[model samples]
Target: MSNVLAIAGVTRILKDMLNDALVFGNVDQVMGTDFAVTAQPPDRIVSDNPDTQTPHLNLFLHRVTPNAALRNADLPTRSGDGALQMRPTLALDLHYILTAVAAEELHAEVLLGYAMQLFHEMPVVPRESIRTSLSAAELAGLGSGLPDFGTGPLSPAELADQIEMLKITPVALSMDDMSKMWTALQASYRTTVAYDVSVVLIERALPVRPTLPVLTRGGLRDPETGRDPGVAAEPHLATSVPSLLSVAAQDQHPVMRLGGRVVLTGTGLDTGDAQVRFREAGTDVSLLLVPEAPARPDRLVVQLPGPAALPGGSSLAGTPQDPASWRVGAYEIEVILTDSEARTAATNRLPLALAPAISATAVAGGLARR
Candidate 1:
C-alpha cells in the first residue's frame, strides 16, 4: 500500500480504538444514555520525505446526541469515556489534542523512528548530522531515493524544531495504539457491531450588519412661510417619535419597548408627536424614534434609558438622570417636525444612542446644550 494509504489506515484504526474505549470503558461517561458516536476518516496525509515508507494522517471524531442534558453539562462531565473522559464540553480541546498528536513534534519523531524501522533497507541518519556534511544539491539528491547518510540537508534537531514550530504535539494515534484503545473500548461496551465515528470542531461566526446606510435629510424651505426651515424651526423642543428604527431589524420581530425619553428638536419641532421604540441587539438592545411634524434645521436628540449605577457618564443632548433613583420604569418625550413632504429633502433615519445608562446620560447632557 502507498504510504499515504497506510497513514489513513492507521488513523482509522486509532479512531476506532477511541470509540471502543469510550463505549466499553465508560459508556455512561462518554456518551451518556442518548448520544451516538460516528467516525470521520482521514482527509489527508503528510510525509516527512517523498519516498518515506510511513506518513501521518488527519482524522475527525464526531459525537451526536439529541440529549439537552448532555449538551448542557460542563466540559469535564461530557466526554465519551467516563473515567478517561477529559472535559468534553469544549470541542477545541479535542482538536488541540488531535492536532498535537497528528502533526506535532512528538508524532514527528515517532513517525520518523517508525518509518526507519519499517524500511530496513534504507539507511537511517539524523537530518542535522547529514546537513552539516552535505551541500543543498547533495542533500536533495539523497532525499529523492533510498536514504543515504550525510546527504540530506536538515539535521534531526533542525527538523524537530520545525515540527515544534508547527505546534504538533501529541493528538493523532498510531495503528498499534489505536488497536489497544479499541480493544479496551469494545470489551467495555460489549458490542460486536461495527460503528463509525466522526469528530468535528467548529467556531461560531459573528453576525453581519445590514448593508443599507442611515437615511439623511437635506436643507429645504417651507412653501407656506417661504422661510429657511432652520430659521422657522424651534429649539430644545419635545416631539412624539416612533420607537422602531431599522425596518430590516424589525423583521426579526424583536421585543420592543419605550426604553427612554424620546424627543425632537429643530427651529420649529415640538415634543408632542415624537415616538420612540426599542429592540434587542444580540445581548444588548437598540432604540429608534421618529419626530413629529414642524421639522428643524438643527439635528434631533434621542437618549437611552439610564440606570442608577450610571458609569460616571451622560448623554450628549439631554440631562443625565440616575436610572436607579428614578421611580418610573418608563419615560416618554416627543418632538414635532414638518412631515417628510414639507421638508424639501431628508433621509429616513435619525441617529440614536445604544449606549449604557451612564454613557447615555453623558451623551444626552452634551447634546442638550448644542
Candidate 2:
C-alpha cells in the first residue's frame, strides 16, 4: 500500500497526470509552455493579467467525500495490547473540474478532447507511474508544469505505491446544476469535464501494535447443537437442561419397545442440536443413543435399537453376564445439550423398561419361564 499523502500531494499527482496527457497526446506544440494553471476562481483566465491569458487547463477541486465502506471499521491494533486506540485510515473521494482555456475555440476544444482521451485510456493510475517531483528541465520539455512562484515551500506528490488504484470516473451533472456551479465559482465556464478520483487513503500516525490473527479456539462444543460436549452423567447446571416430558412409541399401542420408532417429547429440547440418550441404568457403560439424524426443538423421532443391536451387546461384552449391556432391563432416558464452552445440561432421568412379551425354550420342563 502507498504511504499517506496529504492533500498537497494529491494535487501534485493530478497535475502531473494532466501534464503527461498533453505531452504524449502529441499536442505539445499546440499547448506549449503557454499552458497555465490558475486558482479555483479562474477570473485570471479572463483578466487583463497576461499570466491568465494563455492556453491552459484549469484544475479545481470541487468536493471531497469520505468513503463509506472504509469508515467505522475497527483498527487492527485495537484488539492487541488492550489498547482502545482506534487508528483508522481515512478514505476520500476527490472531485476535480478540468477546464480548458484558450482564446481560440478549436484550441480549447482540442485540449479538452485530449485530456478526456488520456483519462479514458488510462482510467487507473499505476503505482510506478506516479511521480513526486519533476525538475524544471523536465517541465520545460513537457510544455506545461509551472515552477513554484509562491513564497511557500513546494508540495511534492506522495501517493506512489498506494494499495488502491486511483480510478477516474466521469460525473454527469444536470444542466441547471452545471450552470449554478459555474456561477458559484464566479468564473466563465469553458470546455470542462468533472472527474472523481477514489480511495485516496491517509493512515493514522499513532503508535500501535500490528494486528494479530486468532491462534486458537477455546473449549469443546458439540458443533451439531452448539451445546456443551456430551458427558457420562450430568449437565453443567441443573436448571438449564432440556426437561424430558415423555418418550412413547409412535404406534397406536404407543409402547416403547425396542426396534420401534419413538418420539421423545420434552420442554427444553427445542434448543437446536441436542441428543436423546438411552443410558443403561445403574452403570457407567453409557453410549450415545441419539442417532446422527436431525434434532428438533420439542421432539425427536428415534428408533430404539434391539437388544442384539444394543451398543456393545452382552454376547460380545463378556462370557456369561454383561451387566452393562442392554437386554431385558430397565434404562434411563435423557435429553442433553452439551454446549462445552457454555454449559452441559440434561433433563431429569426418565425410566424406561425393555421387555419381551413371551419367550419359549425347550428345557427340562419343555418350556422355561423365569
Winner by lDDT: 2
- Model 1 segments beyond 4 Å from truth? 1-295, 299-331, 336-370
Per residue, candidate 1 scores C-alpha lDDT tens digits across 194-234 of 22222212212223333567343334655787654453343
Give the per-residue lDDT digits (tens) of candidate 2, residues 1-370: 3334444556566677776677666575765545654434455556566345667776778888987776555456365567746666777888888887776557778877877887898888776565533333444465434554222243223456556667888898778978988898787777678888887877645776566785444447557977644444545554444687787667744346655666787766755456667776777655455534676666777665544432554454542123234456677877767663455677787776666545456788577864
Every model: Cα RMSD to truth: 23.3, 13.8
Model 1: residue 160 alpha-carbon error in angstroms = 33
Worst 10 residues of 1 by lDDT: 160-169
- The TM-score values for the models, in the order shown, are 0.19, 0.53
lDDT of 2 at 90: 79
In model 2, the runs with Cα more than 4 Å from the true position are: 1-4, 30-33, 37-40, 49-52, 75-86, 131-158, 209-305, 308-370
